[model samples]
Target: MKFRSSLCLRRTAAALAALSIAGSAFAFADDDARRAILDLRETVKAIQADLSVSKNAQMQLMTEINRLKEQNRHLTGQVEELYNALEMEKRSTRDLFGSLDSRVEAFEPQTVVINGESVTVDPKEKQAFDEAVLHLQDRQYKQAENGFKRFAAEWPKSPYRPDALFWWGTAAFALEHYKTVISTQNQLLREYPKNPRAADAMLLVGSAQAASGNLKAARATFQKVQKTYPDSEAAVTAKARLASLGK
Candidate 1:
């Protein structure tokens, strides 16, 4: 009975020791689990910060790309306008004379009418004017404008003055310089009322005004054409334009 009791006490003590060891292990495991949870939370916060930064950068890059594309589109429009002006100038040169205009000074300013009597032109003025027409043909619009301006200044009272004004306005129109066209065409109407090309100039002036988004002014110019040159081609085109406005 004494031996059995001692053996029983030993087993009870072993069991208590095992329970204490298990309790300590459980405490350590809880501490480690809490630390792991804190680490994961910190890692999650860092990832969110990085994501915000990446999204902001992507939006900014997209905005820059859009801005660049708009600028590129604007530049392309300018290039196309220039090319069209050049082609129009070539057409003008071809239509004016089969031979190209010369650039020599002292060009005589005169009219070469298909139906009207020819006048004696200053050789220098004629050459300069011809050269200006050649520039129009080449699509050198600015140069053509300058050349025509020079011709107007040289022969302000010449019979061909109306014709020069017409060409000047035409060149400006080809360049999308509509305001200048209106000014030049008005000068043609007021200064050379009896000019053969006056009716045509008025029509073109109205067309320019229309193209520039001045609907009221264009209508006014067209009205003038209808009143003054009812039988002219310009009047016919003006009537067509007026009829199409409501559509």
Candidate 2:
């Protein structure tokens, strides 16, 4: 009986040891599964962060593209406006000269005297004036300058004297003889202040002074346009230029 009881106790001890080994294996499996789950969660979080960064970069790029497109559109609109303005100016200039041409043809007049008595002439003084005008129309600047100069020298006190002086200045400006341009334009402004050409002469003086690198003189001339001929075209142009120069 004692030996049988001892064998029974030994079998019981073996069964307890097997149960403890099975419980340890189960715990290790649980821990490995938990570790795998945690790793997967960390991988998912990292992927989401990368995706967020990519989305933000794409959005910023799109915003910058839209801003650049808007600036380009504004610049294009400004360019179009400038082109339209230039075209209108060209059309207006053409129409003005066309009307002047027609009027000149319709009102061709005869000779008129200033101080001298009437002299027999085959062609009127108007014919000489027309010839000078034709030279100007043909862009024969030197010939036009000479013709107008001769007209002024011969008919010093003639009614057409101021017009001749104005044309002479214009021709000299076209020839890039800025000194002569300033001299002729100054003569008109100083000597014939009430003449219609005087206002235009002031503008020519400013232009000549500016071209000759005399900014102070140009500003003075432009200031005179504002003070003396405030409503004239020269004054309007001077205001714009002065504003551009921060004056």
| TM-score against truth, every candidate | 0.53, 0.50
Candidate 1 segments whose C-alpha is farther than 4 A from its true place: 1-115
lDDT of 1 at 75: 97
Residue 42's lDDT within candidate 1 is 92
Q: After superposition, which runs of candidate 2 have C-alpha atoms over 4 Å from their true positions?
A: 1-124
Q: Which has the greatest TM-score?
A: 1
lDDT of 1 by residue, 9-45 (tens): 9999999999999999999999999999999999999
Q: What is the lDDT of residue 139 in candidate 1?
A: 94
Give the Cα error of residue 59 in candidate 2, in Å. 99
Q: Lowest summed-lDDT stretch of 10 residues in model 2?
A: 114-123
